[model samples]
Target chain A: MKEGRETTGGIEYVVGAEKGIREIVRDEDVMPLLESALSAGASRVEVTDSRGGTLWACGASSGNNDSATVERRPVFLEGEPAGSLVVEASPGSQLRLNDLAGLLCAALNKIITNSLKRMLTTEIHTSVVNRTYEELLETNKRLRASESRYRELAENLDRKVQERTEELKRMHTRLIQQEKAASIGLLAAGVAHEINNPIGFISSNLNTLKRYISRFTEMMDFYRAAIEEADKAGGGITEAACRKWSDLKLDFIVRDVEELISQSLDGAERVRKIVSDLKGFSHVDDSKEDIVDLNTEIERTFNVLVHEIPEDAEIVKEFGSLPGFLCNPAMICQVFLNIILNSLQARRQGLKLHVSTKHVDGNITVAFSDNGPGIPEEVRNRIFEPFFTTKDVGAGTGLGLTVTLDIVTAYGGDIEVTSCPGKGTTFVIRLPAERREHVKVR
Target chain B: MIEFDRTEKRMVLKLVFYGPALSGKTTNLLRLHDLLSREGRGELMVLDTRDDRTIFFDLLPFFLVTPGGLKIKVKVYTVPGQVKHDATRKAVLQRADGVAFIADSRVSEVANNYSSFENLEKNLAFVGIDIERIPLVIQFNKRDLSDIVPEADIERVWRPTGIPVFMASALEGWGVVETFSRLVELTYDSIDGKCGLSEGYGLDREDFVGRLTKRVQGS
Candidate 1:
């Protein structure tokens, strides 16, 4: 119970510490009992506090304040010792003052208890009322705030619509970009297919041309030997053919032609490899999930992304042998591309992205670790949220990690990211070694 | 510090016990009441709710006018730790001189403890109390229960806070008095340093704490 509430100016609820005993035990309330006990053949009656501070007494120093004739008992308020009753019996009194003292103590305690209960009830009721009033005030404040917000919204309704319209426009642009990307993939696949046909025939023609050139060289040698034989017989026709061949510079021409054809063959081979990489990227977009050697799929994805990688960037690979896994290779490649590109863009130079693969516990785990400025604490968890980019507007759509998460989760896999703000970030992706449906029931 | 009457030389200091709901805050107060009442100290005034929880606040007050003509009154209060009592908690937390955060010792209540601690920090700031300057202690209650957090692990996590941490079961009444005494001492020291209690009124730290903690009759 709080005590001693003074009307301190500008203070609402200031109180002293002790809920004093005198407030509950007044003289008017206990004087009648004291006088009655004095008439009940008792020589003396008294009431005092726990500290022996007297509140009421109808007794003299009878029995010489003797311990033998005196009876004392503590009074209580709400189960706490608040005061006491001390009754002294003169030697001539026939009544036991101890019994009288007990009765007085109980009576006094009851009065104090009832009074304390009322006080507590009042205090609690007041607290409840104050709490309700405060609550109403809070509610009013909130209502006013929301009403003002609504008014503001109404005043700027057109601006609000325009803002939403701008958002819709950006969404439409993203939709078109996604459609264009898919179409480009299909078109690139078509181009690769078209180029593959010409490359096959050109390669065959170059082989045939090589064989013919060799045969012509052998024929020229045979003719040169016959011409020599003719010269030995002093034939004018053979001598004229030798002079025309020398004038044509046939020796240098033959050597140069062979080298030129070999170089063209090498260039054609490189073109074919590039087309193959393009096919890996594009042709798989529309295909069903392939039973892919995971390592080979990783190699194809990296080969397609080779141009984007910096020339001096160190990429360490720790690829473990893994079993064939079922996944859409194109979608998986997108995940790889997004992660690797994030690593590349994380720093200006000396980027070291460590990619590792391992098979353990029926899952093939791939981890991409980057030596770059890592994600800050505040932004780490939200990095995968769609449209939650830290990059400048139009610089990033922020859908990369979201899409990667979708692809990995769709394959019944999960991704984990661990990063130190100043050191680096690591993204570990785990996909099942085999499709869930293919697992043996036994 | 709640109030100071310069003319009367009276200083009222308030200490609050706060924690998550069912984290043994009121139990600690009850233990204090039980142990302290036996020593003829003040009765524990529990403003108990109908649900048997703290709604407003539980108060146990110590009033003393020292031999040196200075009145130092200490009020120990426990706020309702339930989530819905935010306003009440904030109100009771205002002008608190010290705080003892009673954390649950169960291994499962780590998140609740963390959120409650954050709430304490935020509410302290809301009440215009500087958290760094105020005296604060952490007590992990319910150490008697099974599946409680290991002491070593708790220390490892809370050691860097630089606040004194205690392990106790209020049910057994082991560490309640120690927590109470420490809070009182710290509160006294803080007020003494700032308000010049010693130089102004000859207030002694040991004397003040001894008078306030006189109710802890060892069970």
Candidate 2:
């Protein structure tokens, strides 16, 4: 198939079936060339493809003429036969037929080679471009998948972090609850003693009253016996009955019995009042948030801590008419109790705690000022941190301020501490008077 | 890493040429294909774009037979040097026994070379191949071009890394074989140390090198 027609080199190359004589050889190109060949004395001329299909034809006779001389030259495309040209010689014509056929063959080969080159380059370009486009599509799909995966991971991590933080907050609240229970347990011992003193006096008075009642009953029995004896003797008084009445001292017993009964009733009333105070101060159902007076809860907390306060300690109250705000009553009481207890612990003698409440700028601020040895500057900053304490381990769980801060902030309130060494300390708590939507259980 | 089949008495190894775009990675392979004896190697397979630029990869395979009849086959590959062809480069670098980093020697390409080298290090780590432990050789290609960096400057900066460096004009076929030979030796030693190829399998070092590096006729 190497016809030595390709312009690059002598190497052989195969042309595809797609490149046919019909596509390359147009009628305009072949007709003029063939007409000139015939005028130069060739009688007939015909062009056919590789498969011998006629592309262009001009014949002198319809059938094959055996008298005419024929010259056939195969046209080559990319060093392969693509078509052929046939010229029949006319008789007695002075034309160089060999030179004419040679020129026509060379012209046809050049055109086919040129067309083949263009077609091959175009095919390679389109195919390569198509493959690259497909690869790019696949790459884009993979990148999208990867991006979604990363986004999913990030979102999952965020959820996990939130869950962990919520769990920690719950654990923190439980710790505070346990600390409050421990403090209550400590206060209960003191409360029992306070109630027991009145109970003891009431029990003693009841025993004395029992003896007085028996004395009165014995005097009545003697009087009844004397009356019976007199009736039997026809309404005459007996001397033995009269002597017993005189020896028993009935007049003094009557006066002492009335006094005993009155004293017993007074002691019983004292015991009842003490028990009622204990019940009111430790209201266990005061867990849920409700609209309550801050001053009232503070007074109840003061009552609960009465037994623990030193004998000469003075508690001063400056009350303002604050509107009821949403709060957990027990938690608010615990907050006041913790501050008072700390004030009591800081000073053993001549301690004064001034508690005040005010409504200003739509907020209620409760302040507790103590004239005890205030917190030093170095230890003041870490007071709200959990497990930070200056007291002995058994005396403090160190979560008092921490719990106070947590509960206050949960109700959308904030606490500020002002202290100076050896002077006084004040804890001011500011709370919004209205219930907020984001209030949480601490 | 390469596969050594004891049952079949055959070993297969791979070497990859890696560098930035148009930095002579394919040129190095083409030069080796021209210089090496045809009996020792297979045909070079190039997957190129319409403009004759390599878009995927090129492969040239070579074989060697030790004196003790242990057959060894080595496949040399060139990854597409374009930045976007990272996936193809990683695929070709898999299980490669050695790497020849072909850097451009022109002054303007110095930054590109360094960045590509950094990319190589990052990709090696991502593929779980320790760049510190892998057998590697650096080749400054296109040395015959004008405005190239001085050999002294390259050596001064690279000597501290302790990797062997060579300057090559891949278009002219000079220094190509030397770079190839050094990488082959390094690969052989690493494989030998890992699998006891020399002690247990009776593989001779010089015999393996000689079989692959023999010159072709009239080259």
Candidate 3:
């Protein structure tokens, strides 16, 4: 397959590198020609190469010694002396012997040249075939190596895509949690107010109780002083002691003290309730699950958001009996909280939040409806999209509805929003009654 | 380049028609055989299956003798375009001086076209041919069919490569000669640059192109 080499008529003719002499001019072919020449009056004949390698001998050349060799002809192949033939005959037959030698030499030259040509062609053909086969093998090996590399890449591509998708999902969940935490941080003031009210009254009630104890101590001190004085005067009651006891108003003090103690206990209980509600709202271990009542989660959300809600707005809960379903309670609480907050924020006053839960047809539907200005038709569809907000920037993080949708869908539930302009907005969420152990939504 | 026998005053140049399966690589050669005159061309030898698919290759020999008696012979070959015939393809593409890449024009075959082109590049590199140096012509064949890729889109995609692009329906005999002639011209110029075809052998580019692209006397 190289260039600049001679291949005229598809043969690479070589010179002077004869492989086998006997293979070119066989003795059998030369002997027949020689015998015919002898019959035509030739005495003897023999053929040999330039190096004296014999190809054929007959008649006198066979050592009969009957005739002297008088004539000789050189065989030429491609203008090169390959061999020569000699003929022995009588003087009268020398001309015929010369002609016979020429004819035999010519025949021998044609045979040798044709044989060499055939050999060259065969050699070129074998070389070409062998080289092509070798190249094909080398090419096949390289192709197989490249093919396996591509196959490995293709196989790993699927796995890489899956792993990346899983990683992105984890990152998205983490981002949502961070956003939720930030929003809660912004609402800390309202939470502080909720806890502070009960604590404030509890501390005031304890002060009042302390003053009542002081009054009792003073009365006891006066009574002891009067008794001691009476003993000194032969155990008699005096006008000064009677005046002091009357001034004390002991009956009124006992009644007021009992009331003060009861009020203080109630304030303490209120403070404990607020703290418990806050603890439940900040459920950080959302991966864990328990058999939860959706209605209970909603009520807890209401408790946590009590101070955040406007004073005029009323929350009406129409709870229906439902069987407990297994779920991550914290996530459900977040969803309920988002919905309730949206309802409470719909109006500054005269906001009626209607929350209802019902179990029917193996599905539980929790609907939160508010009688306030409804979501616009254009914005209604995009409400659940991440980072979609209707509230002013600092008031809402825009992840509330998106996170709600994610949690609900992850639990094999779906949420739908129906809002009519100037009427109200209702968010209806449906969940499967049966527990699904491993449900992946979206 | 296949063989340049200086002693014989003969240069055997090789050109290959490559593409995805059923994109009509063989049909391009057949069309060229039909269009070109017999004075400088040989018989088209096709090694095909009974189903009309190329099994090994197709060879179409072309010849050109310059005024100075310099003989230039071009052997045109088409490899089996099926994906499983990679070995046959590599063997056929051993030393190609030029190539014509025929592609399916159907919109649905975009992926197949890209994949086949990548395969061609890989195989060409394996055979030790530099794709950037070798003269290449692209043919968006099967333009006669419906739902074909738009010519404008083809231009937009292939224009930056600076390779000549042809849209042809080989079966209908349109754009085939143009593609063949352009490829022959490019191949001649490239070889001329490398080995001095005109300066050393008096092989003029136009004369060679004219001889090969000459229309047949009858059909």
- Chain B TM-scores per candidate, in order, are 0.94, 0.95, 0.97
Each prediction's Cα lDDT score? 0.76, 0.77, 0.78
Strongest candidate by TM-score: 2
Q: Which stretches of candidate 1 lie over 4 Å from their true place?
A: A1-11, A14-19, A22-95, A106-114, A158-442, B2-12, B33-40, B47-52, B62-73, B87-91, B125-128, B194-203, B211-219
Give the higher-DockQ candidate: 2 or 3: 3
* Candidate numbers sorted by DockQ from highest down: 3, 2, 1
Candidate 3 off by > 4 Å: A1-107, A208-260, A435-437, A440-442, B1-219
Candidate 2 local Cα displacement, residue B159, angstroms? 14
Q: Write the per-residue lDDT of candidate 1 for residues A275-329, one digit (tens) a residue.
A: 7776676553455677777677667767766655678889999899998887766
Answer with 1 or 2, whichever has the higher lDDT: 2
Query: Which candidate, 1 or 3, would have the higher TM-score against the true structure?
Result: 3
Please, what are the lDDT tens digits per residue for candidate 1 over residues B116-199? 999999888866778998999999999999999999999999899788899989999889888888887888889889777778
Each model's TM-score?
0.47, 0.60, 0.57
- Judged by lDDT relative to the true structure, which candidate is superior, 1 or 3? 3
Model 3, span A13-103: residue lDDT tens: 2111224556655567567888987888776777777777767877764433343446677875433455677777755454455567677
> For candidate 2, lDDT tens digit of each residue in A1-442?
1122231111112112124566765578668877887777777888887677878877583354444366789976434355788777766556666777888777766665555445544544454455456567878999999999999999999999999998998898799888788778878898788878767867887787777678667877977877887788766455775566567766776777777677767777776766666666655655667788998988888877888888899989999999997767777777877888888899989999899999999899999999989999999999999999999978899998888888888878899999988988999999888856666664
